[model samples]
Target: MSGLLFAALIVATPFLLQAVSPGDANWGKLSEISQAYGAVSVPLSAAALAGVVASLAYQARQTRIAQEDAHRSTHRELILLALASPALRPCWEPPFVPMTSAEWERIAFTNLIMSGWENAFRLGSLSDDQLRLTLRGHFSGAPARMHWANARDSWIELVEHGTDRRARDFARITEECFQAAVLAGPGVQAADYFIPEPTNGAGGGGS
Candidate 1:
C-alpha cells in the first residue's frame, strides 16, 4: 500500500505543482519548466514502478521460502514423534535386528539423526563437503555404524523405488562414510580417520 502511494505521489507531484503555483506569473517560462519536469518525472515514475515490481517479486520469494521452511519443520517434527512413539513401532522398527530395548532405542535415535542431516542437506543447509565431513565424523562411532549397517539396504530400496529422490545422493554419501569407517579399522579415532592430515598448512598431526 505504501509503495503504491509513493508511486502515485511521484506521478502526481508535477501536476500538483502546476496547479498550486501563482497563476499570474510568466506562463511561458512555467510551461517550459513544466515540460522539463515532465521529461524527468517520466523516468522517475518508470523507476518507481520498476522498484515496486522488484519489491513484490522479492516479497513473493521470501514468502515461498518461509512456507518451505515451515513445511520442513513440521515434517521433521512428525517423523520424530512417530519414531519415538510406541504406537508407530510397527511402521518403522527393524525386524531383522533382535536387540534389547536400549539398543533398539539407540539405533532408532541414530536413524533420526541421519534423517535430520539428510533433511538439512535437502534444504540447502549443508553443502556436499559439509555433509560428507559430518557423516564421516558421526559414522566413525560404533552406534552410528551399526545403525547404518542395518538400515542402508532399506534406505537404498526406498531411493530406488521413487521415494524422495533428494535422498538418493544422501544414501551414497552415508555409504561412503560407512566404507571409510570400515577401512579405518577398529579403534581408529574419528579425528584420525576423517581428519588424517594437518590443516591450514600446519605440520602437526593427530595421534
Candidate 2:
C-alpha cells in the first residue's frame, strides 16, 4: 500500500507543477525535475517491490513449517489414543512373537514411543543430534532395549529396502544410539552412551 501511494505521488508531481506554473519556462523546469525524480524513484520502487517479494516468501516458508508441526502433533495424538484403547491397538501395533497380554501391551507401548520419535525425525521436528540424544536416553533402560531387540529385524529390513530416505536415516541413527546405550552397560546413565558416529545406513545386532 505504501509503495502504491509513493508511486501515485511520483506520477502526480509533474501535473501538480504544471497546474501551479503555466509559463513555458516553468514547464521546461518541471520536465527537468520530473526526469531527475524518475531516475531516483525507479530504483526506490524496485527496492520496495523486492522487499515485498522477500516478505511474502518468508511468510510462505513459515506457513509450511506451521502446517508440518500441526501434522506431527495430530499424528502423536492418534498414537496416544491408540495406546489407550485396545480396539485401536491393531491399527499401529507391529507384529511380534506370541507373548502374554501384559507383555503385548508393554511391547506395543514401547513401539508407539519409537514410532513417535521416527515420525518427529522424519517431519523435521527432531534434528539428527536431538534424535540421537533422545533415543540414547530412551534405550538406556531395559524395557526399551527389549522392545528394540524384538523389533530390530523388521526395522533393519525397512532401512535396507524402504523407499523413504528419511526413515532409513532415522532407523540408522536410532540403532546407533541403541547400540551405544547397550555398550554403556544396563544400569549406566543415558549420558554414558558414547556420542554417535556419522550414520552408516546399517543396523547393529541385538544382544
Candidate 3:
C-alpha cells in the first residue's frame, strides 16, 4: 500500500506545479500590457491638446480679417463721399464768378446738404417733394431772396428736428450715391451737374 501511494503522489505533483506557474506568468503579462497602454495615452492626449490650440488660432485670424475688411469698407465710403462732393454743380464757381477758397468751402457744404437730401428723395427714402416742401414751409415767412448760407442753416435745422428714421435713410442714400458716382467716373454728371473746369497746370484747378 505504501508503494502505490508514493507513485500516485509523484504524478499529481507535476500537474499542480504546472497550473501554479502558468497563472503567475499570465498575471505578469497583463501588468506589462497595462503599462504599455498607459504610456500610449500620454502622447495621444498631448497631440489632442495641440490640435485644439491650432483650431483656436485659426478662428482668431479669421475674425481679425473680417474686422479689417469692415474698416476698409468704411474708409472707402468716406473717400467716395469726398470725391462725389467735388463733382456737384453747386460746389463749382461759374465762368464769370470767381470764388475764394472759403467761399467755395461754404458753398460746397450747403450743396452737400442739398445733394444729400435730393439723393435721399430719389432713393425713395423720402417723398419726391418732401425736402422742397419742408424748405418752402420754413422760409415762407422770410424774404424771397435768400442766400445759400441761410438755406444750409435751415436745412440743418430741419434735419435736427426730423425723425431718426430719416437720418438713417439719408446716410444709406449717401453711401449709395457715392458708390454710383465712383462707378460712373469723376467726369460723370449727377443731378446737380457740375462741369469740371479746365486744368491750368500740372497741379489741376482748386476745388
Best by lDDT: 2
lDDT, candidates in the order shown: 0.77, 0.78, 0.53
Candidate 2, residues 9-110, lDDT tens digits: the string is 999987887787756566666679989999999999999999999999999978976996698678778767866787886776555665555655666678
Candidate 3, residues 1-207, lDDT tens digits: the string is 999999999989767766777655666677699899999999999999999999999898679657855874665465456446755544433422355444444444445455555545644677734654544432232111122323434545555676655554543443444344344544211323456777678876779
Model 3, which residues run further than 4 Å from truth?
1-25, 86-207
TM-score of 3: 0.30
- Sorted by TM-score (best first), the order is 2, 1, 3
Residue lDDT tens for model 1, 129-179? 999899877866777777787888998888878655567888888898789
Error of 2 at 27 (Å): 4.8
Overall local distance difference test of candidate 1: 0.77
RMSD in order of candidates = 11.5, 13.2, 22.2
lDDT preference between candidates 2 and 3, better one: 2
lDDT of 2 at 88: 85
* Candidate 1 lDDT for residue 24: 80
Instruction: Identify the superior model by lDDT, candidate 1 or candidate 2.
Output: 2
